[model samples]
Target: MRYPEQYLQFIEKFNEGEYYECHDLLEEIWMEDKSDKFLQGLLQLAVGLYHRECGNIKGARWMFGNARKYLARYAPSRWGLDIDQIILYIQSCEQALPDADSIPYAKAKAMAFPSLRLLIDQS
Candidate 1:
């Protein structure tokens, strides 16, 4: 499937604290490409962020970790994200690996969506 611009827009919304909007935006891409690990990872992170806004920490952690695992093998940085910064951020997040029930996007997108967020989170 062609990379959709809406996906980019979702990330923009996410960075702006529009968690719900991001989820809604990514859901479109996700529904169309349910089997795509990259999109799944990206969408899941958005949903996780939505959950984070709602205080669902456990769900956020699960989705963020899942997103990272998928993207780690895929090198999502080519699509976005700063490889060097990610390596460093991920290392730090890993070292601290909060044991909370959730991984919050307002504070954890770098280690959550990681590269996908990097593309959208880039100011």
Candidate 2:
């Protein structure tokens, strides 16, 4: 299959705000397609979002850093996604990292999480 079954699940889970599940689903595909840099970046992004939701600021920051490395190659568009917004979102996440680490848990919990989106190809 060009796109694994888990890939579709990842898209669904990610869009549904199930970041944890999205991480798991993306990993299933990433494990099999290690050569796909775009997929690797997407997986890291998913994991980062999950960690952020769970209040693991360190994990989130680390994953976002890793995501930046891979995602840099595909900025505006890649793999049927509009990743420009995502890159910007990640930058904001990086900026918030310090505050998230120092702030109280309840206060940090109020921070919004970025949801992933796929650019639908009408053609």
In candidate 2, what are the lDDT values of residues 44-85, reduced to their tens digit? 888887677667788889899888888888877765666777
In order, candidate lDDTs are 0.59, 0.74
lDDT of 1: 0.59
Candidate that would win on lDDT: 2
RMSD of each: 5.9, 2.6
What is the TM-score of each predicted model, taking all chains together? 0.63, 0.79
Winning model by TM-score: 2
How high a TM-score does candidate 2 get? Answer: 0.79
Model 1, span 10-93: residue lDDT tens: 757866767678767877777886877766666665665566555566776676677666656656353555544544544443
